[model samples]
Target: MTAVVHPAALPADLRAATIRTRVTVPLRFPDGYSTSAEVMTFHGLADGREHLLLALGGWEQVLLDGAAAPLVRVHSECMTGDVFGSERCDCGPQLREAVEDITATGGFLLYLRQEGRGIGLYSKLDAYALQDQGLDTYDANLALGHGEDERDYAAAAQMLRAVGAARVRLLSNNPDKAAQLTALGIDIEEQVATGVHLSEANSRYLAAKRDRTGHTLQLSRAGVVRPAKAAAGKAPGHSGMLARVDALVPGLRARAEEAEQLRRLPAVTVQELQDAGVFRILAPAGVGGYGLGAQSYGEAVRVLARGCASTAWTAGHLTEHAWMLARWPREVQEEVFANGHMPLAAATSAPVGSARKVPGGYAISGHWSFASGVMHSQWALLAVQLDGVRLQALVPNADLQLLDAWHTDGLRGTGSNDLRADGLFVPGHRMMDWAQLTGPDNPGSLLHRDPLIHAPMTTLLNLVAPAVAVGSAEYALDLFRHQLLMHKERNGSFVRQADSVLAQARYARAAGAVSTAQLHWQAALSLLPSEGQADAGLPEAQRAPFRLSLALAAEAAQEAVRLAAGGSGGSMHRLSHPLQRIQRDVGVLLNHPTLGIDPILEQAGRGLLGLELTMRSF
Candidate 1:
């Protein structure tokens, strides 16, 4: 779909003073219009029916009339969002939505043809081309020798004045736009906000406008805007990262204890993740599942991590799988629910198994490792080859023997180990392929396409293991600080280990790196769509980069632990010391391929340079 370019008028004085403004036009509004004149377009506006386009472009506008007043609009255009609907900016929505609201309120809109802060369309487009190469708008403009904000607004003021618009309640978010017109002898009786809302698309753009570009905006309010509507089911933790973490701490603790004790999550803990009347999270509230994260699930994972990295990691992985499982068609879920809420555990990594297609489904045989918290699970989901397809098949846990291979150096409490499915039978309906997650097939994919499934298995597998690294690092920092203070008070000194400047620097360095690494993990987890989308599988292009990010974060965590563990000197070598356990855990964590720095860095370099990323044998 072609991109839409709706330009705003230059400021009141420069209106058409530099670049050519579109035809100076007058708008007529009809009182009580139902907001469905829909879109009146300039000759060049793009179609909005396309999803990507709708997501990428601003709405179009038509002239309108109001009941109590003539609906006058500030009808300026933006080069960034209006043209590209770049998530980094809000100009597109600001231009289009203003027209829509005015159309609904029986108002007239002044369509300004300003582009790229008034440097003109060609220059603006050129700037965008440069930006795609990593330059910001300022540098891009400078590269072209166009001054920032080259817009001329005198044309717009004259057009409005010519149209007999003596007074207006200007629709605008930028105080500059409003003030400019007011100063132009066009009485802005009032200012109505018509700024584009924030989204993953235009956050950076908004920030740039308010910061580098000097656009006057009430940015505080922008952060509070929400979608006109939310998805059907959102989790309690979706509000924000901190809130999600705080809300899930209790649940995380419950899961950890359950894992530590070699059991399943208690009924209360499971129920807490579910909403009233849902059997599991997939079933609608009326069906015994908490339909959380139709809005709130992502926020839940972030916050949960802050309190306990292991718990958050475990929950995020498990919850994401649960979301995928639950999205299966309602009829399919009904059949499953017939057995009551079944406890299922999925391996974070692909199991080394194969499936042979059979009449009904396929015979599945293989064992998947690192099935944490599996002891209490009634069923095991093994990714096996069925007719050569990588299928996630549900089998009775009894059919799979626990390998008891969870003797890991860290995350000792996770109880993650191998589960063997020597040979298991699965009905056609009981088995699904990993690709069906992104395919048009699968009822679940149709209702919910979780991008989580699309994520490269290795990268995701790394996330499952690295939370322990985060947890240990955090715990280590906490211990180091606590110990230093205790030692100081006991010794009547202002400095304990920190008394030595080197030690102080060590703690600070470790703390900062650990915090940064912790945040990186949190960011990756947070980026997963609240509801898994078809793209959950990170595209091949992104896998290597993500692997690199994983490596960087993991390496950071390792160094953090190393600094702290060594900073405490020989004291931390004692088995009973918390630092010892943290050291051991962090050390073990670094061995995971996902956590290993070298491989990840190499893969990342390959991706960035567009070189082949060969899979290196572990």
Candidate 2:
């Protein structure tokens, strides 16, 4: 009920010594926009500040002297295209750009991370899978039961209070968000332009936001929410599978030893990520959707991670994918999401085949790799390479075959099989260039580059791995603790080994490690909103932290597994043991290229060190 301030945690003397009157920060902008930072100082810094550059384009500071109120900003979240400049949305750039503009000019950003409007990273991805089929943002939301925008500024307001700010100006494009902040008691200092800078990739999205949602862009919110074509009967929120699946975790773990060797992801796992609503995660309100914010999305992921790792990973990925697809043109979406089997769990990677340029569309051919949930997917995304660039082709199962390919040491039940496409025809409009996305100037781009479209892709995809690893570790540790209690209550021993002092030490250690990683997981998710500022000269800083997320999660994953195994003892090695699966799963996760020498991770570490060196402190 009350907000607590968490200023620098150090001696008062040291804190005072480091306190400043003005803060410096890197300004991040969306992929294609640029601006000078002079206005930031005059308008925002008129009173002066003791500031610190928290990130590129994104940061917070004590303003106009310590007595002044604090400020907040919930920068949008979009990784794939955002951090990597993938061209899906302008989120990454917007984040950094906004920060620099606000912090330098005269304000603070609350950084209320709501990536993909709270559909979570993976669900946004599923939306992309649908986008290849042709759906606009609203249509996709309708199909998923996800709101038009899944974001909230509550935490940001809380964070501001922590820094001692009672009232402040809010910088954003959406009037709804600003009003919400004002209602919540966050002082609205002023409204500023945070739209994705113009780029051919995101022109349409900008137009849609301005037109449909009253986004205060150059467009009008008239017919933007209109169905591009016809509504698919399956509209968002129609599917309630995610909720059902999430309820199974605690009960499944109640019978730990017996829960082992359970291959059915549906029957054995319980967590928010695996619930019924998961299917409609990307669908909008008119169609039925929660349209939660990034905090909720991340919270759901964290909750699921407490149960079964594989299940959480699969569910999160599928859910995010659903949202991303929600932003495509209406006709394209209807073909995929509106039919009786519209909510399909299918996708293809690897572009195992080829496509030839043809009239109207490309005659596509290929075998896709790692098509997770292929058995459940009526539609699939097959990646193609044409004109020296990769393009995604959305097609129906009628044109493709599910090939047995997802057999792996971990997450086996995910059904990530390969799809074989001997010869398929993807219409010209059915495909788009991966690099053509730049939010502000989008033509077909904005209409498709919904919030999730801009999220860092590799970062989001890799999240599944960590979620699974951490959840598996949680389940394993919970089982181990339960076993210890049963031994003590029965006044009995566990194979003569459970009574040992080592077991007690390990139990605490494993629990602590799992908890530690979980904390870090939340910490990493918190960084999602601070990726960019509005005034960065380049995209370097925004790119680094997103890259670092992979490593941060990987570290958390390893710590979780090590602690879980340490607590379990030798019995964890049994073939039928759940620990065995967890062990394999974490191991497999460690091998993720994103963690193994990933440039992103390296960049994050560098960024951290660079900032410290620059400021002579954090």
Candidate 3:
């Protein structure tokens, strides 16, 4: 264990520590976000362990201007989460965010090597073991004969003073950091709360910190957003929802790798999506939803994909499932939406299950694969073959088994697991025939006056894949451009790639592809048959054209990402790079049956030639 000597014990007029070494280093994060830091080591008296201070952004200019206090963060190290991407704690994300936030302004990040909060790594792991057997983090430490928190900020205060940061805007949620520094003669101009990095694996740990240690963590599980005040001439629903999600983009991008490692959407991400009202976009306004149509829903999914494709994929499907549930019998809809909120449901039609006719309902049994968002869903929409007919069955999650079978090379965070059911009884009211569910005169249409409820299900479902594809490809292009502009080669300038004519041509081609994809997407949206009009029950000829446009959009999106990936250099091949992940995600998305270029194109041809439609999904 590292020894700690409290700075308060020393004389009030103590001298500042001398700087031992100072060096500048170019830094590259796993997400391909690049920056530089002036790393400094100090000669200190208290706590002899080596600690680092990274001066980021324009520190000298900030000091010279004296307009704002320098942002500072005294971060304690956690090897498990920080280095290995462990989900047991929020250390990794906090550290990553602190660096980026401080770098945005002129600031310092004091990376203290106080592993395990000064209890040492081994003891921390021991505490984790105790936690597994029913102990909070603090209690676990206390059980092992250690203070609830062994961390001391004496060294941190010294480092800040040595770096001439007598006053700073401390970026931390822990009040202890500010209190300790203030007691040790540092002026904490402000104690800014860090973004809450909550995950399913660390929810309890964070709660423990908040309740036990008085950390300023706003842990809102439901993620309810307050109503915005009405403004004259401002577009309502869509803009409000978009603004909420736009604010969450940075946090989502930061947690993308962590979500992938967990093989599911984190709690914080799910909450953020819920807060943004993405899941409620399809439900009728009577049920407290936005009552928006496919166009709005698709736009939101595209926006979400720019941050994390897996999240967008899962969220898009979950949103669609809510719309699907509206087609069920009125009683079932009432039950599902009785809680005054949109229900989270996951659906799968592939590897169809079998359902047997019973007295009150059907008994569902079989394994369904690729149920995206199932981990967080309260209900599962299982497509089953009953005798010779296909039907949709709504089964509560309690009745179905969720298998951790979503292991894949792409879109790993979706948690698209396999769901199993053995004689699970689903009431007749909750079951609807496949034809009626997608038909124009479905139950939802009769109940809700909104034209969206009467829209074609096939076309709406087909739009989801391309929205994710296009958004991910666009993000890839942005990352690649940033890489060319920021990352410098050993013997070349950072702008060298930007100046290359060939590189500019490639970038232009990629941009054109993205624009083309977006055009196709808009064309598809435009083709939506006007519900409550003469075209309400549109034929296959009209719908097939929509699918064709989406297929082309998906193809163009993939091509754009391919171009960006080719030019992103070898450094982006690392698993942590966002560009590489976007490439893999778009590749997998193009393989979806809804966006299959060959089948969709062939179906369009069949429709045009006045032939029968062969593609069931289309």
Candidate 4:
């Protein structure tokens, strides 16, 4: 009902804030978006500030029954940017977006008279002059003897209580807003991330906000939601998979810990992957799959890893295995795809088993390690040496025994455990020669004639590791910045690590490392043949360099994560902290045999010097 002032916290003579008046106003934006608002004025504010609330949609009725927390945006006034078409800041676009979104969702836009982050109009212009001298937004404020951000939520909180809004879903990217309002007695049910409004002029300004003030702006996701692709059955291709996987990120992130504790991907996560058509991204359209290529696969994996590394690793490997399965004989493919559904399979490329030729097949026996996605897979492809020839033996899951040996520090949700087969017999049709399978004239390529099927195995598999590294590092950076601005000290005061010069420098370095990793990762992807192009297979000379780029990217990603983790104080190491989990997960990803920096570097050197590749995979 009224402002939630703490007992003995306010002077007895202080007046209680109350709603003074309300008026209906129709609003139209430059982009032609139109909405009407019930603008309400406030009186008796503690600070005597001239604050207002534009109540939109059915906000009052929603508050009447307490059915849900209304969405709200607590925006500060910015005359130059909000009123003018200034590109130096995102304030104009954000205000427009807030009005449109809040109207649709039934909420209020609390417009406070705190210009230029609580500095007067003339002071903000002075800071802009200082910014022209190469100082960042925050540094310019400090140069003018003002705090990085001087705005407070006391008056805004008073207005919200006056309107009977005790709880809300905060629509903001700045954690400071949420932290302040939460401290001022508002129940923030959620912190909804806003769309990134970026331009050439404001890139640096946005970066400063992200690194120095912990704003949740992802430069990669630059615009709002795009138009939906054609219906699912139209074979919407790679872009469709990107959107589909993007939709699954929230659920995947929510289950990251459950996956870790179970030491395997949760069964529900597996189902969600299947429902989302994730396993079909690499499969050929002939079998009702996307028939996409390397670049698309890499992009999808990177996006998925931002949610959960273990889920990405497992799903990524499984999707690759689907493409690998198509390399088998036409008869074997028929047996597997006969059900008219994309088959889930797990594969281990390590040649660690033995096989003996039988009358109509081979009796294979071996212990395979790192069988990712095995728990949910129906078939497994194991590498075995038969009469000194390397072959991949395809066996139904029923013929093998799964070993409980998947305990590890990171990516534990991958379920990359051991599988054992004691003299198990595999049909002759299921065995594929490793050389022929990875060669240019593989059966899948002859049948489907898709460029993706003709791509080199090493080149394609290497895409996932670096993508995972880049994504996890990006997630860590976001978390690190948010904590720097929002995490609390033992005495219940804000830590404000972003105010520290050392933390800002560390954040800048880590952010740079992540950008470097992305560059290398994209370079590696560019070397692969496009989905529409015919792949004649990559030459050894090209393959070695591609591998080198991926290795470099992985190394850079690890460096970024390590830098962020190091700057994070002792509290970050707690088991419950996500940063620690990410740190551990990236550590395990870097140690992957394919991403081993030493071997990759040596191979690159050999290729440059015109020497033979020492490694079989290269």
Candidate 5:
């Protein structure tokens, strides 16, 4: 690809336009092919909207030559198809093919912002709903008071002229594009044909375009392409569970205050979660659980947290404990899961207890604090030192005594009380060595086929609390935005809080912080090893970075929540306000032992500096 110089001057007629060059960068494709393209923006076109000009290869030079006719494609923006890869239309594939074709030969592709054939996005969605009601795309637009094709080419013509393209070989199946551009004083050297992109979802839409719009392309109706089916015996996907949880969010948000007041997740909320099958996310597939991967589980937790952080926190820990319990001996797993229903377990790994080894098991006695969800758990996985080895002993709730000592300013609804166990005898099958559980070749690795069950405990355990923090931050941002819309100055000024520039800046900062944290969290989740891969844990160099990323995620959430609370007025300080609760919850979550920033940063710095690790437990 050759580079072309930007024009030094524009013609008298185009001088008054609000045209500016935005960026020129390499656009990479999935096939490893890349090309440089200049992204020029034209602001004063089509309802004061901005249109983009992607001059590929040496197209700008070709256009400046006046006699040379560059290949041009006038493309319309489709948010769903282009950004989301939605197969409801061929827009995404067509856009990809056009970029490849234009890059091969010097050409220009104009990305017009005329979404939904100029009916706008929401209207396009309404049109989609209408299309589902047996109307074609054109008729759906007409039903919405829009023309069959409302997009105009005047902007494309003006953009071409401003870029010094006097004539062009148009790449399009629609002859109307050539006719419209020609009528707008753009000389069409030739009308080139574009290949048809066919799929089951867009077959009818394509047929309508070809039959009614005079588009020239060969399309076949021999077979409709469909997505490949999942493998046999595969568990159902998480979409249904996520949708169920999403539907339950409003009710959970309504009862958040009640949960806080009761110092526990409301019984109704717990029942709703059970009904949604949320606790079974990490259960074994053979036991009728989803056995979702880490990424899917993290996403579900994030979604649940958006409504109520304490509930999400308790739920995440309990679900993760199920996954951990899968690492125990097969007999123990069967003993716990014999009922074919998901079980909730509260856990603490601080090793604040002592266990004495006996012939069959260990006599465990301890008082564990911070036992989140203990009120709802059927069992407890208490960390203890037995015969100089750290192990987790699974004791039935019947043997443990719960103390009424859960008082906290943050995460108030977690019911994270202290539990006392006095010389309880846990069977050998019910205890697991901490080292073996954290290693790659754990008992669960041999018992279950799900790789998520075998994932490194160090990495997986750190993710649960952070997931709730991320969700709470997102919820805080939403609450702040809503507050801004309703807030007013106290001195009788009628100006809305959102109208203030400072508030807008804070909102932007908070949003950016949350997005950055989510990106980091997703990156860490992606590093989990897949099924049948080597058993070695994540590389040492990556371990610290992963740990640091978890801290960053928590810190980012803290920052976002702080910013949101600051923007909310004095009323936000009240206990009834969700913002105050969210702020306090995120604050406590960020202080989690594994999610502290200083320790994580030091470890990351040590790893980057090639120093011997000071801590090796992970």
Candidate 6:
């Protein structure tokens, strides 16, 4: 055997080549580019580990034919940085850039499972704990009884050889990776440096890597790394909007009492919200709105509620009404959104009005209550019964008579007063049949392909109120925590409320309940149809469960707010205290006919038991 040695064969000691599998698949990016890649997997290596070899765009064939030096990167796994977008390191950005580059040029990328520089996950967490105590990365590793860099390149070399990549242009910032590959007898034609993904959290770690391990990274005078410009036409996520709302919370909190005294949202707060684009989230993008999805809309409401629940409630209604109006005919939409300005609308979905069918329209006369944000709206979505059929009529705000009927203990600032319309002639174009809106063949569905409009009307309607409850509960918890830390006992002992075990447990329980409620709400939202997909529509059983989940979310929020109020003691009962208002607001929200827990639970239980539901609509 010594007379002739085969270059493709592994050494005798590392001969267990038990499994080799390859599949050609297409890798698509969110940016809409796609390319073919050969995903090769090898198992039972010398280290009893497996590795993946991705050969992009016929690079495997090129390597096999010995015709080119492919662009190669041997990447180690970092779960926190890669999967969770943690800014503690540059691993995520490096991996993303590597994929884009390798996919662009025919190349090979070896993804190794060596996590935390081969220190293992839990040990790496321990190392992180040590680093938090002022130890550098190298010292943290040494303190944890490991080398500064414990990762080995033998498996990477073996995978490269198995894939027939004898020569490569290495894409890496670590000089040690290149030296290790070179020492493994693999030919390195060139080395390409990756970008420096910097943040305040990872600046120290990055500097230590560059100083100690000879990493090729350039840092600015402020120790920050600048990111590359984003690609054109890419829409930002809800994080930016959430950040904007978060910045307004303190200001909004300052005006809560003023808003209650004014019997509506403070004019300044309303203008600030309008300037921040809070009311236009669900408006059509063609009309200069973001047309955001349910998750983002719910999150914005939750964030706004942290400052003032009543303001968030009004904002939520206006945004939701815009979404509902998007289902109207194009002519109606144009009329409502004339002059490129978004029209804030107030909606009452219950069919409480009588409509007489007239030529080219219906004459509606009725009283609708709980019209949140009606004072600031230019239009109203009124539900009426026309010719014994339910219809949603969009009437101009000028046609409706506002009644001062919004007296309530909680959510007084919402200005949810009654509005009456006497023989108002709403054009046929502005009136949509309630059944048509719920059906798959509505005018909105035919005209606009936004996924939000395609969702079940009942589901969307039920989701609106719970957003305020969730936000109010979260705000209540924050107030409770602040009171605990800041307020001392009046018994002259200077005892902190947070020092009590009961207070800690109460905070933990309420936090868990609110968090779980949000999860349920998110899960229900996920079941809705997305854009461009055929409307399969959820089954009745699923809809029942969804309603039950929403009701539970409301109940959970109420419980959390109650707990927070109780934990805050008698000071929370004052009229000026925001917690008292939030408690009252959440209480009123829970009493809503749609979000009442008992009826929803009964419906869900009936569905689960395969029993006939008592309610006809559900």
Candidate lDDT values, in order: 0.53, 0.52, 0.80, 0.82, 0.77, 0.75
Backbone clashes, each candidate: 71, 150, 0, 0, 0, 0
RMSD of each: 21.4, 25.4, 13.1, 10.4, 20.1, 19.1
Please give, for residues 1-618, the per-residue lDDT of candidate 3 as tens digits.
223344657677665688899999998878788889999999964778899999999987887787899999899989998899887888988888888999999999999988887789989987886564446788888888988777778778888878788889999988777777887888899899888777545766876778787899865532223233322222247666667556666656766776787889889788767766777877776665667666677888888898899998998999888888887768988999886667999999879999998999999999999999999999999899988899998989878888889989899999999999899888888888998988878987778776777766765677789999988878888877775565332433323477778888999999999999999888887776432233253466676777888889889999999989888677567676777788888888988888767877788999888899996667
Per-residue error (Å), model 4, residue 337: 1.4
- Worst 10-residue lDDT window for candidate 4 reads 224-233
Model 2 poorest ten-residue lDDT run: 220-229
Best by lDDT: 4
Taking the tens digit of each residue's C-alpha lDDT, what string does model 2 give over 427-463? 8766755444223232323444234344434445555
Q: Model 4: clashing residue pairs?
A: none
**Every model's TM-score:** 0.51, 0.52, 0.67, 0.63, 0.60, 0.59
lDDT of 2 at 310: 58
Query: Considering summed lDDT, which 10 consecutive residues are worst modelled in model 6?
Result: 223-232
lDDT of 5 by residue, 1-618 (tens): 111112232233532244677698788866577778888887566346788899897775676565668888999999999889887887877788888888877888999998987778988987886564446788888877888887877778888877777588999988777877876668999998887775545755776787678788555311222223232234546676677677667656756766787898877678767767777777668665677766667778888888888899898888888878877777887888776767789998654799998889889998899999998999999999966888888898878989988889999999999989888888888888888876767777787777676677666568777888888888898888876675332454545678889988999999999998887777777776543344356788778777777778878888999999888767577676788899888888878887867777888899878886787844
Question: Which is the leading candidate under TM-score?
Answer: 3
* Model 6 stretches with alpha carbons more than 4 Å out: 1-236, 349-351, 487-493, 529-536, 610-618
lDDT of 5 at 130: 56
Off by over 4 Å in 3: 1-235, 238-240, 487-489, 492-495, 529-537, 609-617
Tens-place lDDT per residue, model 6, 229-266, is 22222324577667767766765665666577677886
Measured with C-alpha atoms, the lDDT of residue 159 in candidate 4 is 84
